[model samples]
Every structure is written in C-alpha cells, then in structure tokens.
Target chain A: MRRRRKGSVVTEILTWVVVVIAILWVLFPFYWTVITSFKKPADVFRLSSIPWLQFTPTLSNWQTEFTQRGPEILRGITNSIIIAVFASLIAVALGTLAGYGLARYKYVKWRNQSMAFWFLSQRFLPPAATVIPFFLLMKSLGLLDTRVALILVNTTFAMPFAVLIMKDMFRELPVELEEAALVDGCSRWEAFLRIALPLAAPALVATVIICFSFAWNEFLFALVLTYKKATPMTIIIAGTEHTQGVQFWYVSTRLLLAILPPTLLALTVQRYIVRGLTMGAVKG
Target chain B: MRRRLREKGNAFVIPAIFWVLTFTIFPLVYSFRVSLSKVLYGKLVGFAGASNYLRMFGDYRFWGTLRFTLVLVLISVCATTAIGLGLAIVFNRKMKGLRAFRSILTMPLFTAPVALGYLGVMMFYEENGPINVLLKYLGMGKVPWLSHPLWATLAICLVDIWQWTPFAFIILLAGLQSISDEIYEAAVIDTSSGWAVFRHITLPLLSPVLGTVIMLRMVDAFKAFDIPFSLTSGGPGTATRTLTFYIYTQGLRNFDLGYASAMAYFLLAITMIIGLLFFRRYRELYE
Candidate 1:
C-alpha cells in the first residue's frame, strides 16, 4: 500500500499547488500593478529582474503624481464622492417608499411590472448606449460639468436597484405593523418613516453601499459627461499622460488615496456586504 | 385607505419616472429620430430612411470591432465562470481562513475599472512593464504588449478576469452554500463516487444559479467598453476595437451620430434577445 499512499499524497500536493497557482494568476494584475507602481521605469521594464521582494523603491513617482497633479485628482475624487453619495441617498429615499407601497398594497398590477421594468431598464444598456442621450440631456440642463449632473444621472440609474432590494425587505416584514401604524393618527408617510424605514435598515444600508459604489466606480459617464467640472478620479487616471510606464509610485499611492476612503467606508459597513452579495444571488 | 396608498405610490414614483422620462426614455427616442436624419451644417437636415443601417452593413471597422468584441466576451465569460466555479468548490469545503481569503479575492471587484485599466497598461507595456521584466528574469525574451493587437486584447481580458471573476464566485458560492447538507449525506451513504455525486446532484441543482451567472457575465463582458477604451483605445490598427468601442468612436468621438445610433440599436437588440432568453429560463428561479 506504499504506492497508494504515495498517490494520494501526490494528489493532495497537486491540489494545493493548483490552488496557489490559480490564486496567483487571479491576483497577478493587482499584485503586478502594486509592485510596479513602486519601481522606477528602468527596473520596472528590465530584461533581468526579480519580482517584488528586491527592488530600489522610489518616491519620485508619488511626489510628482500627487504634488503636481493633486488638485485635479482631488476634484475628481470629490466629484465622485458627491455624485455617488448624494445620488444614492436620493435613490434610497424614493425607492424605500415605492418598495413599501408595493409590498404592503400588493394588488396594483402596475407596481410589480414597473419595478421589474425599471430594474431591467436601469441596467440593460451599457452606459455606452445612454452616454449619447445622457450627454445631450446634461448639456441641455447646463449641468454637464457640475457634480449635480452626476447626481441626477446616477440617481436615474440607481433608483430601480434600490427599489428592488427595499421591496424584498419590505415583503419579508409582517403587514400588521404597517396596518397598526396606519390605524393610529400617523399618515402613511408617518407610518413609513416611523415604522417601515427602521425595519428595512439593513436592506437600505446595502442599497446605499451598492449604489454609491456604482457611482464611485463608474467610468464612462464621468469620462464623457464631465470633462472638467465633474470628472472623477477614474477619468483622470485614464488620461494617457497622467498614467504611463512603471515609474508609478505616485500613481498607486494616489490610487490608494482614491481607493482608501471607499475601502474604509466599505469595510466599516461590511456587515451589509452580505446584502450586497445576496442581492445579486437571488433575483428580486 | 387604498386610495391613499395609490396616491402615496404616485408620490414616490412620479419623481423617478419624471427623471427617466426627461433623461433616459426621451433621449432614446430623440436619438433614434436624429439617427434617421442627415447632418447638414452641423445640424440634422434630412431623413435618411435605413441609410444609417445600410452604412453599417458595409462598414468594415464596425464588423471587425464587433467580431473582436464577441471573441473577448465569449472567452472572458467562459474563463471567469469556469475558474469561479472551481474556486467556489474549493472554498466551499471546510477550510481554514476561507472568510479572509474571500474578502481578499473580492477586493479587485471594488477597484474602479478606469484605475484598473491604467494599472494594466503600467503592468503590461513592453519596455517598463513588469511582465517582460519577470519574463527576462526567468530567461525569457520580452514581447511587445500595447503595440500589438493580440497582446492588447489579452491584457484587457486579464484585467477583466481580475476585476470581475469575484462576482461569478460570489454568486456560485452562494448557490453552493444554499444546497442542504442532507443531499450530500445521502450521496455519501450510497457509496457514490464524489464525481458522480457532483455530476448528478450538485451540477443539476446549481444549474439555475450557474445559468444566471454565466448569462450575466456574458452580457457584461459583451458590453465591456472602459477597459478596452482606456487601455487600447481600440488601437493597433483597430485590432481590439469592440462593437461598443466602435459606437463610441462613431458617435461621441468622431461625431458620426447616424451610424453610431444604428450600431447602438443593433447592440441593444442583440443583448435584448440574449437577455430575454436567460430571463425567461430563470424566471422560475426568482419567483
């Protein structure tokens, strides 16, 4: 049975090796980006070099990137934050009410259909399709370069998703609370504010995180819609002159800058990441 | 009471519908009309009447870009789904540090796509990018990255795989976790081979989730624009030009609105057909 033991041992070793390789392959780009960002152009592209552990790290890239390009990047970051946060708040506010109305009332034929329609329509077009009309509409409003433009556009896209999740949460809440609240002097709005909204807190938290991230990470709209005033960090990074070669200590540091706030916010609310995960897991 | 409810419903949705009507649906129809019009003095002049559609028929760039997009989408979708499924299974087993590992794996999904695109260029460009450096360190020769069509596509695809495979993993793992423990115990008692049990039980049961994830990723990959747009800009003689990229080129960048509209409409039509097919198949899964 020595050969049998050998075979199983080999199998186990092979599995571990495969897993390690796969994980490396998955992380190659990010790891490579992080590593290269610390290296000078010469070391970054050398014909003979080790990966990661040994290198003459440089702060030159970061110094140039943030010191010279700081304000531009900051504007974009601010725009992204403003757009993502405010838009999601607006979306959550409207969606929460709509969700409860549908969940509680139930008989309206239009409610389910409209919600589904909005959900599908909100996401169906790659921002590519809408970019044109969205641009035109933004131009008409003279809101093109303002963070307000992003807020409006992002809210349009975010509302349906926010509504879908909130509806699901509301559906799970027993109807008696709402009925009792309504029976009291509380208007439907008061009942909604006083009762349902609190109950749906978890879903709302998830909705806000998800929507905010979509706005924050959004590339196309920011690229096209806001050339100057509302440009996000994503667009600034996309600029060819700003992003080049391996002398990128500054880029990744700046990248870390833009990434950190959202990352911290995300980690802080990571409890809701389950809602984020499960949202896409089950259909609304 | 119900009437009050109806009024409440109207109150919440009216603002949202107004936003969509003003921005989204309105512009969609308006753009269609303009697509049918001819540009005269930087303004729409005449109704083209399928001329825009006909123009796309002969546009080699549009077709070439479309073919490239299909290849990118097909490969990325299959690759992400296969790798994601494998990872999900591995992590599904009782394991050490799975939670922490999962959080790490998902970090890329949170990185903005535009930053990821720039990250790709810095990491893959021939002279200073680290891939070639590592290659040479291992005694391999350096290869040009951005200057060539094939490597550019590969680079973009790698970035997507890094950024998005977590999405597939999350969905599939959720599916796997939802399967009850009893089913596995039954299979174990039957003395069934693990592979057979997986093929017969796990695979079939996971089909709905698997199907949805695949369809979602495929559509997502198909419509992918930012990575290819930012990294390659459909460069190296239009080798990496995707259909969506072509739309941006023709419409926004080049100001060829008529042709771009036709291309956009065609993309919408294709995605709708595929999306509807998946939506119908999985309707039961949701309801």
Candidate 2:
C-alpha cells in the first residue's frame, strides 16, 4: 500500500509536468506573435519578450498596416470572407442533400457505399495534381484571378469533407422518425426539410464550421488562383517580404488578422471539431 | 412507392454529381491530356509523348526533392504522432482545467498553415528569436536554424509538428476515452505494475485509432508546401523544397505545364497507393 501510494504521487507530479509543458508549447508561439505585432521594427530584433517591462509596446506596425497598406489588407480580408462564406454555404447545402440521398435511398448503378467512398477519395487527391488543371480550367473560362474562381475551387475541395461528415451523421440518425413523418401525409421533401434536416442541426452546424475554416485557411489555391483583386489574407501574409528581407513586424500583424476568424470559429464549435476533422470517425 | 422514393433520392444527388463532374473529373482528365502534350507558357505547343515523364528520371533535382519529401513526411508524421499520443495519454485522466487546456492546445489546428509558417520565421529566427534566445539564456550556443540545410529541414518539421500534434492528440484522446474504465480496472487487478496494465490494455485497444491518425498525418505531411514556402522558402539550396513546391514552381512559375502535370500525376499515384494500402489494412482489421 505504501509503495503504491508513493508511485501514484510520482505519476501525478509527472502528469502535471507534461500538462504544463504541452500548454506552453501550444501557446508560446501565439503569445510571441501577439507581442511581436505590438513591437516596433527595432524592438522586433530585441531580446525583449515581456510587454512594457523589457520594452515599451507600440502599435506602429498595426498602424502602418492599417493607414499605409489599408486597401490591400482590406481587399484580402474581403476576398477571404466572401470566398470562405460562399464556398462553405454551397458545399454544406449540396453535401447535406447528397448525404441524405446516400443515407435514405438505394442506387442500383453505383452503390451508396461506393459513391460515399468516391467522395472521400476526392479528399485524398493531392491538390498539386488538380491545381494545374484548375488553373487552366479557370483561365479558359476567363475566371482566373477572380474570387469566383477561388470559391468554385474551395467549394469542390470542401464538399467531399461535408459529404462524408453529413453522410455518417445522417446514417447514425434513427430512420424511423423520417418514416413516421412520411406516414403522416408529408411529402418526401417536406419530411426531409421539416424533420430530418432539423434533427441533424448539430451536425449541419459542425459541417459548416469545418468547411468554413478549411476554406478560410486555404493558401495554395488562393496563391495560384488570385493575383491582386481577389487575393486572400493568406496570400497577403505570405507576401510580407520586401526587397531588404522579410518584414517580421508586418508579417506578425497580418498573421493575427488571417488567424482570427478560423480560430474563433473553431473555438465556438470545439465539441464538433474532432468529429468534423475526423469525418465522424471518432465521436468527440 | 419505392421506385418513386429512389428517383427522388437520385435527383437529390444530381447537383453534387454535376459539380464533381465539372470541377473534379473534368480537371483530372484535362490534366492527364496536358501531361501527355508539350506546353510552352501555359499553351499547348505540340504533342510530347511521355517525354515529360521520361525527363523526370534524368532530373537530379527531382530525385533530391523526392528523397527530401519522403524523409520529411516520415519523420514529421512519426514525431507528431508520438508526441500527440504521449500528451493524450498523460491528459487522459480527469483533471482540473482539462477542457481549457484542450481548447488552447487545439487552436493551432484552425490557424492557417501559411500564417503559422510566417510565425515560424519569427519563432525560429537565429539572432534573437524566442527559441535561440531561450537557449542563450540557458548558456547554450545558438543553432543556425534557417541557414544550415539539415537544421532548416528540422525547423520545417518542427513547425509542421507544432501545427498538427494537436490534431493527433484530440483523436487519440477520444480513442482513449472510448476504452471503458472496466478494462483498465480489470487489467490493474491482474497486474500490479502500471506499465504491464498499459501495455496489456491501453495499446491494443488504441491500435485502430493509432492507425487512422498516422494515415491522416501521413497524407497531410506528404503534401507539405505552405510551411516550407513561408518558413524556409525551400532555402539552403533547395534542401527543403517539397514535391508539391516543385510542381508549383514548374507549372506556375516556369510555365512548364506538361512536366508539372506529369509530376502531379506521379504524386497522385503515390498518394492513391498509400491510401489504398491503408484502406485494405483498415478493412482487414475491422472485418
């Protein structure tokens, strides 16, 4: 008993040590970024980490970004918001219908399982493979360097994720409820919208959050698809280098801008994130 | 009634099917054709029958980048999974402030990889970056993080691990949670040593989740571009250039569409093979 008690105490202390380390590892970069954004150009090269104590905090970088480079920054933010929002909305809408179809009905030519797998497989295709083709397709359609081009690309990529999550969610839901609604003299579409869709509200919200976050943070597509007018915040952040070198001060501020929306969205739907990320593989 | 329902359901899938046919299937087929044809400045000049594919075999840069990519994927995936699993195991027990801890830890998952790469530039800066600064405070020498080839690769992997470890942790933690307390209790009763119980109970039960998290991380790591692009710029003489980065440069920057298309198809082939193998193993494990 005494030996076991001693061992447990040791394990408890070790566990807390690991926990503290994990927390610091995760938060330190974010902390550094936030603090760095507040520092002046010279102070950025200083060894000061603590705000005000090690060095006086200034908003020169943020001010310069807003006043001097405001239009460019605003354009990126607007494009990112428009693209992410539309892409997620379209993906979730189409995915929910297809998900319900796969869950409710049987197809003879291509089995539901195969169709669902087809959607999942699309997610595995390296974006590199399709990027050239997508660029060509967009260019041919006169959609290059446009927000519409990005929205179309982002929607296609995010749709598979939405389809997979909603498919699993719809499959797990009890079918009897929809069946009972059908027997109550409701049309199939009516039963779906009134009963099935409402019942899957939590999953719908989760899918939307995940899809939106994915589209918001997408970089490669934005980098290739847009030039000036439709540039997303991601492209703006990555292009923070000047002739001298990378302007770390400006990059820090821009990163905070690009990171804010998706981070907030993820926090709001924290519970469903694991499920959405894993495609409902593990029920978080 | 059944026939009517089937038709309605099939109609519901039309929009999704149409979108896929236009965006995915059409693009893939076009890419294949582009891979087979010679293109100059994004315009098809002539037919190049497997010459682009044949050129890759002679290209030393292609071989070097391929080797570096495989190494990066292997090391980063393994390191992320190990650290994530370690953290999950340690935090699996009931503890105060666990939810807050989890929320904070997983924040990286939602942030843009490109943004994180930019953050990495500051965090890993040699002269006065936080990491080197801390090492200096501890009376240690500052390592040249971005200048040296090997160290640059390590820096990229470190950033990748930092961003992705949370993903592996959450999934594995959920996997851990799903394993009932009864099994652990039963195992503890049979063995006095904690290691024995963990080995006998926890690992076996967690294998399926482990397999899944590894596969997901592998695929993501294989397509690594943003971090390398923003962090190192594939610097120290292309030491950190990924295959995707190579494809991006060839296709977009150099306008070598045919060669880039061929490389892209090569990447797709590799990804598909890995995915198929994983699925086969997954089916066997479940069935």
Candidate 3:
C-alpha cells in the first residue's frame, strides 16, 4: 500500500463523508416511498420512527391499490412492458445488423460520414425536442393512447445507443473468425446470425436492458400520447399530482407501486449496466 | 451478390427505419406543419406561417418559462457535475462496504421521477415537513420552501440533485473502472501527490465521460417538468415553469397548438445545437 500525507487523508475522509451523506440523501426518498407504500394510509405518516422497516405493516393500502387502481396500473404496466419489449427487440435487431454492416463493409465516399452523422444525430437528440411533434402526429394517426405509439417512440429513442454500442462490439470481434467461417460454406447472413450474434449476446443483452429502462421510465411523451387508457408506469406516478393535495396515503400507495418496475429492473441488471457502459466506451 | 447483400442489409434495417420514420421523423414534420397552422376545435386549420412564431416571441409566459429553464439548466448542470465528480472520486477509493454503498447510492437513480416529485413537495412544505423539522433539530428556524421564488428554485434543485447525482455517480464510476491500474502505478512511482495525480491524469482521462454526463444532464435539466410541474405547477406564480411545462400548458391545457408548437421548435433548436456540439467534441474520445 502507498503512504499518504495527513492532509490528503483528511481530504479523502471528508470526501467519503460528503459522498455517504449525498448517497443517503439520494436514496432516502425511494426508501421512504417503498416504506410508505406497504403501510395503511393512516399509519403511513405515524411510523416515522421506523423509517427503514415496518414490523406491523398492513396490506390495506396495497389491497386498496389492488381493488381500485390495480387493474388500471396493470394495464399501464402491460402497455409499458409490451412497448418496451417490442422497442428493445426492434432496436437491438436493427442495431446489430447496422453495426455489423458499418463495422465490416466498406461504403462509398461520404456514405460512411453521412451514416455516421445520421447515427450521431439520433443518438444525441434530447427526447424533449422530438416529443411534442410525436404528440401531434399520434393524435392525427388516431394512435393516441396505444402501445404502438409508445413502442415506436421508444425504439427510435433507443436505436442510436444500440447502433453505437453494437457497432463497437462487432468491430472488435476478430475478422479472422468471420474469414474462417467464410472460407467454409457460410454466407454473410450465416456468419452474422451464427458467429456474430452469439459473440455479441452480452452486448445485445446490455443494449436491451438499457433500452427497456429508458422506455419503461419515459414520462413526457407518455403524458402527451396517452390519457388514461394506455398510460405508462411513469404517467401513473405522475397521476399522483392531485393525490398530494387530495389524500396523502392514497398518493403514497400510488407512488410505491409506480416505482416498482424501475427498482426491479435496475437492481436485476445492476451488474450488466456497469459492465456494458464501461466496455462500450473503450471498445467504441 | 453485392446487390443481394445490400438487399439483406436493408431488410434487417427495415424495422428500425419504419419505427423512426413513424415516431420521430413523422412527428417532427407534423409539428412543423402544425406550428404553421391554426387549431380549430381539435382540427388543424389554415396555415398561419410565421404568425405563431411572432406571437410566441411576444408571450411573456413563454419567455418567463424559457428564462427559468435556461437558469435551471445552467445551475443544475454545474451543481450536479461539481458535486457528482467529487463523490465519484471518493467512491473510487478502496472503502469498506463499497458494493453496498454503490447499490445504496443508485437507489435515487432508480426512483420514479413522479414519486420523487411529491417527496420534494412533502419535504419543503411550510409546516410538519422534514426539512423544517431538521431545521428545528439543527437549532435553526424553518425556511419558506415553496413560498418564495428562490425557495422554489431551491426545491427543484434539491429534487434534481437528489434524483440525478446517482446517474452521474454510475456513469463516472464506470469511467473510473476503465482507467488502467498501471497509470496510477506509474504516477505513484513518480512521487506524484494525490492532487498531482488527479489534476494531471484523472481529470484529462475522465474528461470524455464527464463531457457526456454534462451534456446529458444539461439536456435533461432543460427538459425538467414532472417534478416542478407536479410539485409546484410552475408556481409560486410561474416561478418554476420550465419551457417544457410551457409547451404542455399551451398545447394541451390551453389548447393553443400553434403557440405551443412554436415554443417546442425553439426548444428543439437549442437542444439540437447543444447536442451537435457535445457529440462533435466528445466523439473523438471514442476514436
């Protein structure tokens, strides 16, 4: 181990202390939401002392949610899931093929640059700029409050990231492996589907998970496109706007269920997120 | 054979192309057309051309929201990046319980924005709120959290910081892992102090990731709505109304589709320029 000066040691300690506090500040709300969710509406605010856990937690609020808003929330969840699944599938599938083409095939002059620019534009655009337009178009198409609209937007939003990442992954795979396969009886499609897709599975998995999170957590577009029929999980959370003013416990229970998808998704894919982000950076 | 391969490649790309065209390209074009037209009872009417843009420029609420949005983005980006970088450096240490710390740290990033919005409203409510409660605990009196304009800014900032710093942490932590052990080893052998190592090595190495994070966070901050929209509804009298809220209010609530589309176009222009700059400069990092 290396030696450090006294001042450096103090700086390090202070840094950690600040970070620990910030982390607590960051996480406390989510913890609070979950804690408040499982409690009876009346007991929700009363159990401030046991903020971390509830010993005699009642299922009344959860039951209320199940009885009244359960189907509504489920519909939203199903919409979110279907949209996310389709979006992720389309995005990753197209992205992999696009990536392979860019990585392996030579294009005419300015073709690469144009394609590169197009990909970059898609990747870098903030959803805010594009969402307003989507609302109007969806209304015109009579696609408002539908999973199709959500799926379309989600895939477009995710495609750039998918392409960028998958390309990097494909580029790094040894050309010799593909060449070796070509030397055998394999055509390009066979080489890609069999050789490249299998090799890129980890990256593909990472891309799908990341895309799902974005789609699942999206709010602004969902609010615009869907009213109540096809509301997403994010919209459901946003639906608690009046609950804050109207009924505190009802709001709390609603808030709890709203965040379940993201919480479950993030925790499950926690390991993959860290690795996918890192590897894609260096490889790209 | 090349033609066949090209056909196959286009076939593979069909799904993505169709999706983008329908959702993104079509929406953008429709927004442009809608911005130029007047809305008549849920139907688009005759084209108004630059008249809508002119009206948007004249609208005080639009400018007010746009100004607040600019300030919000600038301040939040600076605040979050400075603090997030410091925390990332600390977490990079060989600390005890780092894994648990990491998982704990990311919980904020995982929380629903809508839920977190209410948490802010609750925290800063004038009476019986934790913020006030904590103030009393610290021997300080309660501060007006939502009543004052500055206080409203503070409320939004606190929520923004609370929600997004975890994202910064995750991105930066991932960046930190990519730095080779040998580089630090070499710096240590050179008798470089921690400051020197950080200033000379880590800063430059992490700039790419930092740039990406800043761009993303700024774009996000500019588009901030759900928290402020849900929490304050752009109040204490339009204090927290962001450009996005303005667009939604105009387009949806007031049903003034023309003005809203114009405002949305302004937003699009600003973000487009910023995004272009971000990618152009930082993209070299990948190369």
True-structure RMSD, every candidate? 3.8, 2.4, 3.4
Candidate 1 lDDT by residue in tens digits, A1-284: 11123366665565566567766765666566556556686765453234545677677767776788778877877877788999999988877776666665533656555455555554555666677777767777787788888888788778777766776688788767878987877887788788888888877887888788777877777777878877877776666334463445556665665555555456544445544543433542
Error of 2 at B157 (Å): 0.3
Off by over 4 Å in 3: A1-19, A40-47, A51-56, A243-246, A271-284, B1-10, B95-97, B180-193, B283-287
Off by over 4 Å in 1: A1-28, A35-53, A56-58, A107-111, A183-185, A240-247, A267-284, B1-8, B137-139, B284-287
TM (chain A) per model: 0.80, 0.94, 0.85
Top candidate, metric lDDT? 2
lDDT of 1 by residue, B1-287 (tens): 34345444667556655666676777788778767877553367788998998898898887898889988988799888998998888667654556666666666667777677767766776874667777877897877778888888788888888778887887787788888888888877675466787888899999988887887787788788878876777778899988888888778787777777778888877777767877677554333
lDDT of 3 by residue, B1-287 (tens): 22223334544444555655666676778788888898876578798978998997688888888889888888888888887787777777666677677777776666667667776776676765657777888998878888889988888888888788777777887787778878888888885577888889889999888887888788778778878877777889998899888888878877888778888888888788777887687565344
**lDDT-based ranking:** 2, 3, 1
What shift in Å separates residue A238 of candidate 2 from its native position after superposition? 1.5
Instruction: Give me the displacement of residue B10 in model 3, in angstroms.
Output: 4.1
Q: Give the per-residue lDDT of model 2 (tens digit) for A1-284.
A: 11144477787788779889999898888898899889888888977889989988997888998998999899999999999999999999999998888877877787776787677677578999999999988888999899999999999998888877787777778887888888999998998899989989988987888899999999998999888889999998877764327677888888899998999788888877777776655677
User: Which has the higher DockQ value, candidate number 2 or candidate number 3?
Assistant: 2
On TM-score, who's better, 1 or 2? Answer: 2
Q: Could you give the DockQ of candidate 2? A: 0.58
Residue A153 local lDDT, model 2:
92
lDDT of each: 0.71, 0.86, 0.73
Error of 2 at B185 (Å): 1.7
Q: Give the deviation of candidate 1 from the true structure as CA RMSD.
A: 3.8
